[model samples]
Target: MGFFDNLLLNLDASVTGLFGQWNIWTSLLATALVGFLTYQVATRQDPDTHPFLLARQAQGTAVRQPGESPVYRSQAAPHGMLLNAGLNVKDPGASKWSRGRDGDLRDVWRQAVAGVQEPGPTKGAKGRILTVLGAEKIVEHNLDDITRQINLIGQHIADQGGNRVAIYLPNSVELLATLFACAFYNLTAVILPFDQPDDAVISMLRRSATDTVVTAPGSFPFDAVVKNYPSLRQLIWVVDEGSKHMDWNEVPQGTGGSVNVSTWQDIVNDAPLDAGKTLPPLEGQKEPRDVTVFWQSKPGQQEEMVRFTAGNFVSAIAAQIFAIPTSQRMGPSDLFLPADSLANSHTLVLTLAALFSNASVAFNSVASQADDLATATGGIAPTILVATPAALLKLHTESKPALSSFIGSKLHWLQTRSLTQKGMMPAAGGLLSSYYDRTVRPALGTTTTTTTPNKKKLRLIVTAERVGADTPKLSSAVLSDLRALTGARIMYALTAAKVAGAVTQTNFYDYRVFDDKCSHFGPPLTSTEVLFRDTEQYKTSDNISQGEIIVRGPCVAGMEAALGVAGKMREDNTLAYV
Candidate 1:
């Protein structure tokens, strides 16, 4: 062979032999270098030009659809790895399901509609979409209803000049409808976490530039919101207090005094559900890209507002990239288990993704109680499950006896988002192994089938990790171990305390700040750049170290309090006061 080829082979052999019996640390270092070299070589080699050598090697791919913006392409590359894995293994020749229309949001709704069209075995008295609340017989909404809801919401926003409304309710069908309504009408929807402190609620409302606040009456008290936020000019509450005629008022009499009120029935009754058969044409000179939802965050001393542009929803990008060729093979009989918040969001995205692929989603609303999960999901025997470490831990701890069935049956893949520690990964792996042996392999009705074209391989994507390339304890050996456990799909995001405007990062993870600093402000396109002058003056990538991270991305609106908590910003806008 050539000199370089022989040299690489010898080097690999020597390193393997030397580190073979060494401590895990040394072994990890050796293994990591080898892995990195392998990755670099595989990545550099083109699939079409050097197909044989780099065939199975997975390099992260970015997903960019036709007519999509360059911003999207840049942001999608890292995430494309996960999407591609899911799509690559899916079956081909599946029946086509289409909403038969255009528009990003509408298309998602259409896809959801198409998924509900397939016939499946009825679990209860009647057939429908599985819900958490006591709605036994529930299925996806029809095309007509979806279209009307979109138009109605859009009309309301058009009438009002930039109205800001809050969707204060639990995760239910109504909540879903409210989101679509907000998007359709082009009204800004501020999602306030119901579980947060009362002060946090007031702060979010004021920071978001909220003019109108909408909440489901009795869901939570609004004394704090009315008392603290002066920007709120209108208050609309959906009161479902066993009354025939719903209340719609401009002035609501409460502890905070007079405010407007609007009922759910009023909007529904007034909306022309059957008017325009198709979706109303997108209005304004700006396309979906101009639609921006502002987020309230800290940039230094200033409270900067970053708006998430349209068509940049992380879920949309994920759907396009993970579209499976043979996904059309399955009809509506499929079921899905989404246990975590992000995974649940993915389930919602999958509803859209399945429009191109032909799979149905059944909610595995497995109760916290293991027995409840077995009963709810066993009858349908879901083919896909999206979960997190906490939920999986609960399952393992509670369902020791039935664990075999839970693990060995129906679970095609395990997707996790929030990972606090590295030690927890082993337990996750054991759970997966047990799950495969007990549920997945048997449920698919195959033993010899080690791989499938329609199903993505088992790979974990770790988001927001603590120890990274910079951590003293983090070594090549640890990285190799992590890769060996979860494969090469381990993802790391190094977020800054405050940043805006999107920039290309050249490493595995960006530099991270401490706790409660960097919050997600939509897709990466909205991120910015920031740097401290004294602590971090050098612009060169080689000199980056632990200084108060200066963020400069589109999403870095400004510092929530430059003079208060995070410290003050320099004259040039860098956060130097920290």
Candidate 2:
């Protein structure tokens, strides 16, 4: 009818005659082919190491010397397009089922940082990879700093003759240093939930027989928790953001037992740099190091101590990294924010997951407050946001008041549909998105534009352990709500005690598949197999599914205990909760 319409018709006719019809089915087939090729490229792996490739290089080149290693431009190895990490050689000690890095967790870090050094205080140093949010200064801890602190901490705890140490601090840079230190040595690290009251902390400490407590100043019931646990003989305190300090001697000593208190600052100041020098003499003892124990409690039951071996830990980290989309892997370039308590399974696992991929992790302490987790995350947008459903629910509740009126939004949606059909604008930059984001979004307090080149897109990774039958954090509602508000992809995860990591996670691209209130957790992670067993105990866990989810895999603990979770596998290879 118009000049442009006539021109478009002519072009379409020419294209059809020259090539082929661009129908819906043809477009879908092209999309599938492109996706398959992209997947192959993204998941590519180099089979042969540079040394091996050079060894097989042509003999006439500069590497002509016999048995000489250095060479260039060699033929590629077979199946060199797989996504892999860590040492490629076969480990004699690694089990066929394991297929994991079989040594200390620190080894994983070594692999992650190899040849990826950044220039800093030390020449080409891998400096301070952690960021503690809400701190007065930019807090960061590098591998060397972490190692030095570990040496000092290992000796201090060893002096007290205690191997099991409980960390009862909020998400901080110090927490990361301490956990890795305990794992490097053979000490068992117990992550105590910082939000618990004194009674719960003391009860869990006594149950775990934790002999050492590491926490920051003025943490919840610090004096009360350490005093009640008689097995705990030492209290290692760390410094807060400000110069504010506390004296352990000033507080009343607990009559329950005689406990010696020390500060992390004092220990680092007093201990020598070579604290781990003596470690070489005791290296070949064949003792299983890095035993990390996570405590999960039921309302009327004793706290469950889930023990994770180094193999289990490595497997869990690997599975978490692979569970992410190949394009959105939490790699070295990403900044991950853990808004929930690091003690929670999801936060803790994803924190280390980011680390294993050489990505820096950022911690938000405001989220640990009584309320305002989502509010605290107002301006700060990290590439990956790992949060609990409770935190996301708080955000959702706070965002509801900021949404546009019902009728106005309906009109805007209709307008967007028509405009998109006319090819005038992108769906993302439609009238509704621009209007609500500009007018109502000031409530969120984000000043920068979402399209800024430097600003990373947000990917919300939610764990539902905090959302129960009585909780307000409905999975389906929270997922859809937060996605609509922030335009971010939300991936949900389910934690099982026996499973070292999340048993299942929603696919990276799958969003809001269920209109019903109940939401699905997607599918089991790689190297994991899951089946449903009929059980009434976990029936209350979900409404649409009734069974105890049984998972046995490389990262799964050997146990048959009912995890009190109900789920079913879908034909699309995802798990949906009723």
Compare the candidates by lDDT and give the number of the best one.
Answer: 2
> Candidate 2 regions off by >4 Å?
1-104, 111-137, 220-227, 241-246, 249-257, 273-287, 290-302, 369-371, 406-436, 440-454, 465-478, 536-546, 559-561
For candidate 2, the clash count comes to 9
**How well is each residue in 220-276 modelled by candidate 1, as lDDT tens digits?**
457667777766666555555365354445434555564444555565557665653
Error of 2 at 28 (Å): 33
Best candidate (score: TM-score):
2
- Candidate lDDT (C-alpha), each: 0.37, 0.57
* Least accurate 10 contiguous residues by lDDT in model 1: 465-474
The local lDDT score (0 to 100) that residue 311 gets in candidate 2 is 60
Clashing pairs in 2: 44-81, 44-82, 45-80, 45-81, 45-82, 128-141, 128-142, 522-575, 544-578
Which digits, one per residue and each the tens of the lDDT, describe model 2 over residues 192-274?
77766668778878877888888876765755664555576878778764643556434464452467777888788777666
Candidate 2 RMSD computed on C-alpha atoms after optimal superposition onto the true structure: 13.8
